[model samples]
Target chain A: MSKQVHRTLSESQVTAISEELNEPDWLRELRLDALQSLDELEFPDVIQTPGRTWTDLSKLDFEALVDPEGALEQKERVAPEGVEVLSFAEALEAHESLVREHFGSVVDPQENYLTALQTALFTTGTVIYVPEGVEAQAATIRTTMAGQSLFNYTLIIAEQSSSVTILERQETADEGDFDERYYSGIVELVAGENSYVQYGSLQDLTENTYNYGLKRADTDTYATANWIDCNVGSRLTKTSVETVLSGEASESQIVGAFYGHDDQHFDVDARVWHENEHTTADLVTRGVIDDEARSVYEGVQDVGRDAWNTSSYQRENTLMLSDESEADASPKLIINNHDTEASHSATVGQVDAEDLFYMKSRGVDEHLAKNMLVSGFFVPVLEEIEVEELREDLNGRIQDRLAQRTA
Target chain B: MAQLEIKNLHAKVNEDGGEEILNGVDLVVNSGEIHALMGPNGSGKSTTAKVIAGHPAYEVTDGQVLIHLDDEEFGDEEVPEELQTWELLDLEPNERAALGVFLGFQYPAEIEGVTMVNFLRTALNAKLEEREELFEGDESEDDEDDEAGYETSPMEGAADEGEIGVAEFQQLLKEKMEQLDMDEAFAQRYLNAGFSGGEKKQNEVLQAAILEPSVAVLDEIDSGLDIDRLQDVATGINALRDEQGAGILQITHYQRILDYVEPDHVHIMLDGEVVMSGDADLSVKLEEKGYDWVREEVYGTA
Candidate 1:
């Protein structure tokens, strides 16, 4: 229809997508404004030492990778009572005021270049709203991308005293001639006072794809937010999960995992900010890489000056299955308040031979024992996943990856 | 009867050009008997146990470790070479385990995520599969496979008749935990994670009880244990020796654990070689006289 739109974007395409979806004038303006911010915003910061810069994102030519016209359809899902779950477009149409109030409030759409790009091009997503004092369970969705590119956003709003569990999964649909597709997704969650929100997602796209994701949540007074983000597929992935304890005595737990094999590279980051007193945060991440694969992890726990009596702990471990593979971890604790209790630990090493030997001596096959240990390494974080199906799905995918590595 | 015979075994570390640790250490333990290997630090008492376990870190330069299994002692799992005795050197650690050889570690490795119940189930199922008694079920496993069809047979070895399901595994774990005097909640914890020294030893005994190995090599099973826990764990070891009639090769630097387990025979090892052998009194003598007299008696040094 329009010269088979290729890997570039213009203001016209953004306006056209908005019109195709029948979006309100305010949304169109938001998209166009995000488009304007792209020229000024830079990609997520990568850790740099004197000799090397980890996870180079500058090489990602967004113009060449972003197929602005290609977007996947969001699957419909059933929701619990007192909870409203709808496709992003449907939510915008039926609950425009509600959508406008919470959108881009928790996660700044113009925070980084990737965020700006996502805000400008995302055409498919889901919106979940749990009303005050309603406990909603089991809201799940799976997005299978079949096109050349995909950009999606998920917004979750939990009202005061409400509890909700949301699980999301993403993967490529089929093996197409265009092996190098692009996928970008962003999640914004707002937990109201005393509300509990749990968001878990696993991305296992084809190895020929490039993936980018930013999931951030903000918690109100005495609220809790938990995130489980796992990645096992994709040629290159740059994903980040952040939580801001904006409410006093709020709690947040970020549990993350990734497995990379072949030439796949994973740039994973988990950060937590303590903005209020007596807030608590726990960040745990584990990864395993094999066969020339590489992974870089950065975990940050920041306690603001006024956020006294805050407790935060961060732990990150990466296991290299092959000598050819590489892994790096940087866990930092920035505490501005003297009364805060903060600690961070990062370790990168090969599989523990003693642990393996112990399992093997117990009559487990060496290959299977190694698989168990690798799977076991992810347990501390996996235990944080409250959704049983998502936990099992993530585990099955990890076992699949380990089996492939063995083969 | 089941027996583990170490014949003039000579072994060395597999790394760094193989530093010799076990030198011509000959030993034997038959079913329904407990033999304590007593020695000072670096005397290779523990090395003998590891060498018999086929630890990957050690390579045997000469001699052999042979496990003789009788139909009365071990179930009907076809013995190789058409003989009841199988040499241990060629088998992997797990294979050795399937053949009814268990190694009780001195310092058990702490593994996360793998609960005690799950690990015990897998290990017991591995033993069952080796004996061709495991239930042949693939439905639960197939649900985990993707459309591309990846097979993750947890207990892999010859074909299996079946795998113990969850409920059955829990029942089995409960019985073993009770038998070992372990609390019910202990089975729910990650394998050896944050376990105390005595708890680790007790866990090893619990694994041995569940797997039902014919011969167990205990390497310093009493290390760091207090008098109460040493007696508690030794009682479990005694049950394995009496209830299953399994052979016990108790390797230790101190003889305190032997007080409760009670060895039928005690052997003193000095400088990677057995210097003297006798009844349980040998341990008391070694404790009183220490290794200097043994070195003087054997190498004319003291």
Candidate 2:
């Protein structure tokens, strides 16, 4: 077993995981193919300037981080009526055709090294299926990491005219027990024609955890998919939330908020691709970094050549609480067609002293005043969350972080 | 005895302290009196108000602002001796506010995402907490062993132990908004965000009414108000003064607001000093003859 654990991934490990899950021959073949691409593919390019890697993925020791033989513990909330939520192994056994048809359809396994690694060695996953014309309530997936390394995958299929909201939370089981752990997750969402899907994710892993997650959605005609991502923990976190508008008249809104403190590092990227005519995309993200923490946000709004009359707007703002904290943002608008309307803005700033004095003059203490400002800073994006519980949950977590700062 | 006194106050812009803005300024505002400070563009009327409120942009180079708290105004409990006389310049802006000093800004900052309800509640509760702590400390010093007995008893010193719950605060806000003829939805909106100039001034008046400060400083609160809104805001300010016996320091370049809210005393400020002081008719005189007359009267050349 020790000899089999080499720097480069072994095919036998891939076959072994697939066999352990009793996956079909096609899935086994896909895993082997993805394992082969790991050697050729490079980590996702995070830095645009040459000779500078803002978030260096090569520094991550994948050999020590990827445990192909790690145990998988899957726990999920009871599915809402007309909604079917199952683990990957259970889904492959009961709904093999549906699982095979939609899995990897939105996010290609060979997209990058991380994706390939996730595809080949994913230990635990969730599959949520909303039937046609069904308006299902929210389903929850709670992941608690208890091991040194864990890979997670989630696939959601909103059938025609169906709608569903999914809230996924990721955190460590014990506070400091899992001192050094690695987490990689992939979420693929497929929204059918006229369907709606809202995906809300809150990640509060322990400070010792290093996390990498990618969530992407594909929307059909008149379909809508909204993504709300809140990141507040982890020693180093790199997440990308993207949406592809593949159907005409479809809309996608990506709202993200993050609060980084201590020495944590957060690299957040949100993107939307307008692939069809008359599609609309709105991306808004707000974050606060304090202490010695650092955050970098990149937002991209791309209007393809054939996507006429595409309306895309992206805005990202990062508020720095401490002078020692650092933040940078880059919002890009790429319009390939002349008929598209697109705008992008990014701003990095500290709390406005005038606004602070204004509140303080009203008798609000300085500490509470700062907390209120930080809380209000996130309101623009928090208001975009369609789920009431999720919005309140995010607000509570923000308050907790502010309290920690005061403490 | 309950008054706000500024004695030979000297202040300057905090950045570099280039020149004194308020030089040897002395003024006294007693409870139940309205004093209008009229001045020209560069005469430092607004700077006085900001300095009194401990705005960080202004540095108080000399002199002191003393605030005397009225025991009956806070509650039936006796005010602590130490809490009675507060040095405004030594305290933070919020501390000054807690001691019943309110400054109505000329250009109120538009704070996005902070709802009017939330902001008002927090401010009001802070003041109440200050009162509660002072009263509690006073009562404990008088009766230490019986302190535990008063813990569960009805709070005669404060409204529910210095904290107003959401429903009660909303109700209070609604009542105050109605009194000011403000739209009910204004309470739910972000604090001063996207508000028209008149709306912003009216909101400031509403905040003053809610907080019920002992000395309310109005710095060009009537600048952007229309005739109707000016009358309404002036009416609200008058009501606050009448109901709470609050001292009013109305600072403006024009005497228009003085027409609606009558002032007992009017002072002309020129070159950062109170050059001339007179009765209400002084505002009418300045309105008709302009500041040239006051400038000539004080400087002997205009």
Candidate 3:
């Protein structure tokens, strides 16, 4: 067999990004290893039926060069007392061993093709560490991704009996001249025993960009992990979010929302594992698509054989604004233990004609009434979001999209 | 005086295998009068209300429902002293609503995610816009109105160019709720979502109070309502007619609600057309003897 440079990112460029991150030698080698794995790893597995697939990842070309020194612009925020919010570079400077212990610990580097690409080429990241028994209100991180190709990584660690809320938002740089671009994001959340971790994220990329994101958390005994992820933009987006209830009596809730328009496509997958006894989970997702846009959703609630007395439920609802738009969903529940209680449901439909007439009969304009219902469609998931500012932002982003469509 | 004239109206539910519902029904609701159109199932009473409101479900096959909107006082000018007569069939439902037409639903749509406050506020803005009362862009700031107790044309106040100010809207909604003896919590809930049967009926009346339409066609607002709720809703309807001086067309299957509301005229509908018309005694006789008398009296049957 002939040896060819099948990978787009090289060892030298991976090393360059690592050096820019101020990492140690071992971490640099890990980046290089991730770069080598990029060729072997494939895109995340997408569901397919006889007639069609939700998102055609095969058409996604990786021919764009990975910028060695991409835009890493993050607004600096001060951490609350007893909490540490530091850039990865600063984390290495002050808490070197802490970063080494937790980095790449929760998320696998070779989990998928995009994960490997982000693992190898990511230059900007942050670590939020809360020790035992610390109670923090909420911290916000806002950043902009620019250039031809960009990658982002985030690590959140909450210790025993501690509680913290992190709300992070990433937006596309509007002034950039890049015609077609790619964005990859990976998030790892660690929840210790009796702890509570809420991570809320919003991604509003440019329509010329493609986005791939994966967020997963591991829960300990009596620990709670909640994820609120919203996707608002991008030409194409495929996100996989997961939670593992590894400890007995652990719990998790994953709430998601997405709004697509102008030929945008989104494939969202959410999964929860009841690995131990007495664990519970709830997966709720709602989204809307319009103007030839499309969306696909897959949710899984797996109750292992030892998951006795567990409870898991899943629900997904989609609303379409335009007749040309389409949506599909698949919700699955695999209950191995007879003692467990589980249910799954999915519904895809257009905006209710009766609802529109009701509002209009009361004197709301047709366009405005449709926009109101669309805005209201996001409320259930927005209420599930822990951070008020993030919820408001997502709501505003939805309105903006609706306004553009109305125009 | 404003008027709503349903002139030899004809309509059909084309989607339901093209079944013609309203067959040349004629009725005229003058300002400050209450008329009840009573019918059994499929008598086309509710369809009249929907047709008056220009509901999209039914198509207007022929005839015209006209709305007479009078001129109003605007500063030094009597804007368009000549009354404008609009054909309801030509107008959208919202446009008809803007011209002081209201239709109270029998089963109000339970729209989740839209709070009562938001829906009411949007409706109020539409009303204001129709009357050219919207605070012009870059005109008076809402702060001034709030400081002076939210006074602006006695209507939905201006928020930010083309919107009613929040404080003024709250003040208006509060006054209407209090007038209707409604709980303050109703403003925060999704529009009619999870509402009890009676609550949904009351909400319809409350919306009518807010919109202050010149002509209100209430369809089965009394159904599923207990006597007490029926009385409360009837009292609210009476208040709207007496205060706003609006004409009302009350559509009902049972005479239970008419007992409280007191219709000036009672019309019995058979098949798709009104066959007989009378005063309050006629309704009482129908309630006492049942609709078999009407079927027999009108068509010489039973």
TM-score for all models, in order of appearance: 0.90, 0.93, 0.92
The i-RMS of every model, in angstroms, reads 5.4, 9.1, 8.2
Alpha-carbon shift of residue A294 in model 1 (angstroms): 1.9
Minimum summed lDDT over a 10-residue window in model 3 chain A is located at A1-10
Residue pairs in candidate 3 whose N, alpha carbon or C atoms collide under 3 angstroms: B158-B165, B159-B163, B159-B164, B159-B165
What is the C-alpha lDDT profile of model 3 across A99-204, one tens digit per residue? 7887788788888767877888788888898899999988777768767777778888899999998898878776668878888888888899999988898988
- Across A114-201, the per-residue lDDT of candidate 2 in tens digits comes to 8988888887899998999999888888888777788899999999999988899887775334446788999999999999999999
Q: Tens-digit lDDT track for model 3 on B181-286?
A: 7899999888999999999999999999988888899999998998878888998899888988878899988878887889999998888898889998888898
Error of 1 at A183 (Å): 1.1
Full ranking by lDDT = 2, 1, 3
Which scores better on DockQ, 2 or 3? 3
Report residue A403 deviation for candidate 1 (angstroms): 3.8
DockQ per candidate: 0.40, 0.38, 0.38
Report lDDT (Cα) of residue B258, candidate 2. Answer: 87
Candidate 3: list runs displaced more than 4 Å.
A1-6, A69-77, B70-83, B133-164
Residues B22-99 of candidate 1: C-alpha lDDT, one tens digit per residue: 889988899889999888889898788877877878889999999888755555544444456778888788878887
Pairs in steric clash, model 2:
none
Off by over 4 Å in 1: A1-8, B70-73, B77-81, B131-175
How many Å off is the CA of B168 in candidate 1?
5.3
